[model samples]
Target: MFFTNPLDNKLRKWGKAKQELPASVSAMKEKVLASVKPKAEPLPKTKNRTPYWFVLSGALAALVLFIGQYTLRQINTPVADSGFGIASQEQMALSSKYEEENLASDMVTPNVTPSDLGIQYGEATGLGGRSYEDSMVEKVSNFISTGQDRNGAISDAREFLKYDYSATIKTRKVEQISSRVQTIVRGHGGRVDNMYVQEKHGYVYFVVPKSSLEAFKNEIKGLVNVRFYTESVRAQNLLPEKVIIEKSTETAKESLASLEGELAILTKEHNTRISDLQKQLNGVVASINRLRNEVTTSTVRQEEIKRDISRLSAVQQKLQRQITDENQNYNSQKFYLDDRIKNAKSEISNLAEQDQNLQDNVETVQGSVEVEWVSIFEIIKLYVPYYWAWVLSFCAIALAVNYFSKRRTIEAL
Candidate 1:
């Protein structure tokens, strides 16, 4: 093809511009230029370089977000047995058993409160207080309240305590018997609880401390010729009922303690203020006594009044009889005299009624000196005749005789 001058000039201008390209341009591009020159635009790079801090910040932000998301999802998630499962997790769970939370102990684990559990947890197990029963009653109560049934235990205890101890020795004086008993008891570390020495009969009662009961009994067998031994000691686990009753009694004692305090205050006041009142009362009492002296014996004030009324009636009748028998001017005089006697007796009777009421008031107040006693009676063995007593005695005697005969008869022979 023929090249025009203008086209040749344009080509030379483009070649100079390409010649300005970097020397690193390859021989390959030169060969491509020889084959067919192509027109194409090259992409440009930023004149300013990117900063290291921006790239580092973007990477750090992405890492932090990934960690936060992982942590959020982990919360409230069920425990698993992965690398981060419960086995590897640094956590422990508390026991959730209701018994462990409530019972507070493993032994005698209470299943329910006493109200729901019946008598075991009832108010009967409450604290104790004082009582008005005598010492004997108090001791028995204490023994039973731990767990023993009341009536049954007391009956059992009484049966065990009953020992018809009847032994007659050659000792002339009561002192010798007492001395011998003391020596035997003390030697075995036992002590006598009670002894009675009277004009008619002497008796001794002692307790061998429970720990020594068996030992003491055994020693006694070797020491004495046990004529009649009917004492028993039994172990008993008292029921809760006794303890409940005892505790109730203790509460009663607490109440009584408050009452006794009030009584003490009253007594003090009586000593101070009521003492003066007592003087007035004593004067009233003295007047009452003097009036009572005016009355007859074998009668209360009411009875006295009746007796005097009868006597007055009898005397008046006799006087009337005498006057009627005389039957003279005495009949006119009798009317005046009989009327006077009737009026005097009527006044005395009215006075007696007043004195009776006063005596009653005094008697009503007299209970301050009176004490209350629970009536206890000896149960007479009425069903058993003297023959039974003799049998019991003869049995005891025969045993003693047989033992003595075997032991002593040989010596005598």
Candidate 2:
């Protein structure tokens, strides 16, 4: 198709008006045309192969996000120790003792009948029809069996065995899980002893009824994934220590009773001695008064009576001094008794506290739960392994849009 220039139309209109250009104008037009050579073709736009800084920035951001997510996830991973504070060696030994006792109970053979042993009753040189060792083993087995069967309930072994439970969880909703843990504990008629909640982590220590521990554990399981959860149950046999405490407490009580009895006896003796001394002193005073009266009324034996008065007066002073000394001695004895009594009472109180602690351990199950917070990015990475691919795709699209937009703008200009 042929195209007409707009300048051509204007020139035709000028010519139809019969307008004649001067020679100088014609010459100038020729010069102008010569000067205005055909517009140099725009240098072909070289393909802009510049690196997309924005895309690179996006990639760097994605890498940083990946690293951060990985770090967060690692932080949430449960430690090998489960972070449940370590138990003492003694406690660990006691825990192992329970297991050993259970195994021994299972291995224990039933008492061999006297008839099976071809020994009649009372023929084994004992009141019972069994050997002493067999009898002792039977009793121990029964005790062990009773302990295991109680399942942390009230029983003979309850006073001697302590139970504890610990668990840890990792989740994105740390605060929510912490609350749920407390709710579960309370629902089981348990009480929270300690709790710490924060944006990224939480800890809850609780004591639940031993009878409800299993149920509480079940509820805790619901709040965590198996992969992100850890748990431990420990049973420590406090029998030996408890027996020692009991013996000490009994001894202390006996000592206290003995001290009280001594104090009572000392008080009675002190009162009786003081009364006797006062009576003798009163008699001496009466005698001295009588002697003085005689000296005044009877002139014949006045000198003898005076001597008798003097002797009575001496006795009176001696009695008074003896009473004073007796009082001091009694006070010293009383102070000694009081100190002894105080010490005994204090010892008893301490032992009682220890016994009470043991009882509480047996009656309740201590539990702890640690909640580790997870970031949203970490959660996404956890659920989607190829999250970085999505980031890369986004960057690629942005780069393409930016490049095409610049191309369009340049073509328009």
Candidate 3:
């Protein structure tokens, strides 16, 4: 009863081992502390040393640049808003004045020399000479070669000098006048721009160079009856407009070049996209072809079905017509049979009534006949004695006569 358990003895040994472990841990911590060394402190950072003047100078320069750019933009804004960029208000006013002066001067004819008109002519320049065309060509060449200022001066000088004349020639001989005018225009080194002819009138529009205009008018004056005549001079200042057009043309050329570059890039991208799209399109086309084939087969089948339906419909219609006809025939036969049966029934009823009446008449006739037969027998009995009496009287008379005859015969004998 006093024996100790084995588990209790083991628990006591475990408690003793745990009590010895703390002394071993303290000795290990003392050895680690004896081996360790102390660490040094980190160094401090230095402050920035740049001068304030450098930053101030940089800010001032940026401010000055921004102000200059803003001022420049403010100055250019109004000029840009005006459509004519380089032309000033003074220049525009001068051009308008020149236009007005030219318009006024165009109404009156002015004495003009070949040099004043900016044309060059030789001594042999005439309506009948080939040098006239040469002189016109020279004038055009000189006008082109001269600068804008000189051209403007020349244009002002020629403003009232250039003449355009139109005349209505009322002549019955239109063909002859037309031929003569054409010859005159050609002889003056001019060309016919337009010509129209009618039965009663003819019209001719021709252009003669400034050098030949007077000669052309002189030649055509007396050829036909001049009904209506008009002369107009072209007097316009084109220098300012020409400068603007030239500038605009230059800008347009630059823009066109830039646009062409962009277009080239776009075209390249478009070609790439198109190639990809073309591959997709090829697939789509293959699909479409397959669909088309399916559609064609389906269409064929649909057509066959439609034909079948149409045939069935036609057969159905024919059967319906046949049924209708049969119904009509059956109805007709039924009506006829019904009418016959009704008539037979009616005749049978009438015959039965007639038979009943005949039976009644026979019975009445039999009764009357029996009564008449008894009456007739009674009458015959009453008549029979008279008939016998008459017969006996005649027999007696015949006996007397036979006796007399016998007596007479005996006497004779």
Candidate 4:
């Protein structure tokens, strides 16, 4: 028999095998080579070129157009026109008119003019209604100094008023006293030009005629308790002083006019500012309304979102409950299945053990049966030779018994 070495045969087979590239690899190599090779066709070239001057001209034109448009826009821009100037002018006119009316209404015409006070183009008088010359002569005669003359005394006396009286009365019943004083002043053809009445005290400013002043004082003295009183009498002309006062009054009136004009201007400015502020307030109100609407919309959306969230939360809670129930059921089923599996495994193990035991018993019984069969075969083989001998003996005994029986039967017959 030929025995070839396996290692040598394998080496020979490996050496005889042909080394060749796959068809797909060869085809891919050919494709790569074809792609790497340069093509024979020539690339096309443009014949025309745009001039730099044309590009530059287009850019310049665009810039000019942009500048022109910008200039147009600047020229077309509207100048804002505000009504504040006009409104302020109108308000100033109104304020000036109102101030003039108020000034006219508030000004009180004087009842006692400079002439009534013996201060204007009049002869000076004494407290007793004496003429200025007579009063001066009497005063010079009574109390003239050594160097002073009658004319000098008279001039000195004429520079001051002859009499000016003011008094304050105190009383427990101010209201009643004030009323009586008013009545007496009125009855005496005098006027209570100014009066202040309070719970504890009263002030009565009586403007009595020069002739009735003494009578008015006496009447008031009878009506109320007099806390203090004074009377003054001095010669006065007051003409030059009145002239200075009139000049000062004129200056004050001029200042008041200037102040009124300035006040009108200020009021006009204030009204203009108020108008602007009113416009701003109206815009603010509009914005507030818009914001309020937005807030209302947001509130509605918020409510809707809240309801949606609530519904989603409820759904989530329900789903969570279902998941919990499912998890519980799954756990219960898992436990039941686990127990069933364990029981099945235990039963299978027990069955396997029983089956092994049965197999062992069957093997033991088969071995015993085989041993018994072999012993039975041996016994049968051992009895096989004696079986014929025993049969022969049985046949001899049967023949002898048959002969004897036949002989006996014959004898009996």
Top candidate (TM-score): 2
lDDT of 3 at 96: 45
Query: What's the candidate order when arranged by decreasing lDDT?
Result: 2, 3, 4, 1
Report the CA-based lDDT of candidate 2 relative to the real structure.
0.77
- Where model 4 places Cα greater than 4 Å from the true spot, the runs are 1-162, 225-239, 242-413
lDDT pick, better of 2 and 4: 2
TM-score of each: 0.19, 0.49, 0.22, 0.20
The clash numbers for all candidates, in the given order, read 5, 0, 0, 4
Q: Write the per-residue lDDT of candidate 3 for residues 55-164, one digit (tens) a residue.
A: 99999999999999787554444331252222334543454455556554542323346666534544344432356444665655554455344334444442222233
What is the C-alpha lDDT profile of model 4 across 1-413, one tens digit per residue?
23666778877877878666777998899888888867788868777788999999999999999999787554333211131111222433454455445543333222334554444433354352366554444443343342223223334453322233444343345577667767876887766667776675566665555566567667756653232222222223333333333444555456555555655665565566556645654554555445435534567876865665565555545545654555565566556545655554555455556545533332211000000011333234343645667778999999999999999999999
Worst 10 residues of 3 by lDDT: 365-374
Roughly what TM-score does model 2 have, to 2 decimal places?
Answer: 0.49
Q: Which ten residues in a row have the lowest lDDT in candidate 2?
A: 79-88
Candidate of highest lDDT:
2
Candidate 2 lDDT tens digits, 1-413: 12565878877987888777776998898888899768787999889775899789989999999999787555443333454332333544454555557644543443455565534544565554256656544545565565544333345453455787887787888999999999999999999999999998899999999888888898898887665665767776766557668778999999999999999999999999999999999999988877766525556688788788888888899999999999999999999999999999999999999989888778888889988876666557656667889999999999999999999999999
Tens digit of per-residue lDDT, candidate 1, span 114-214: 34433343236442224435333344444435323433444444221211121222122445454555555666565566666543235556544444444
Q: What lDDT does the true structure give each of the candidates?
A: 0.45, 0.77, 0.52, 0.50
All candidates in order of TM-score, best leading: 2, 3, 4, 1
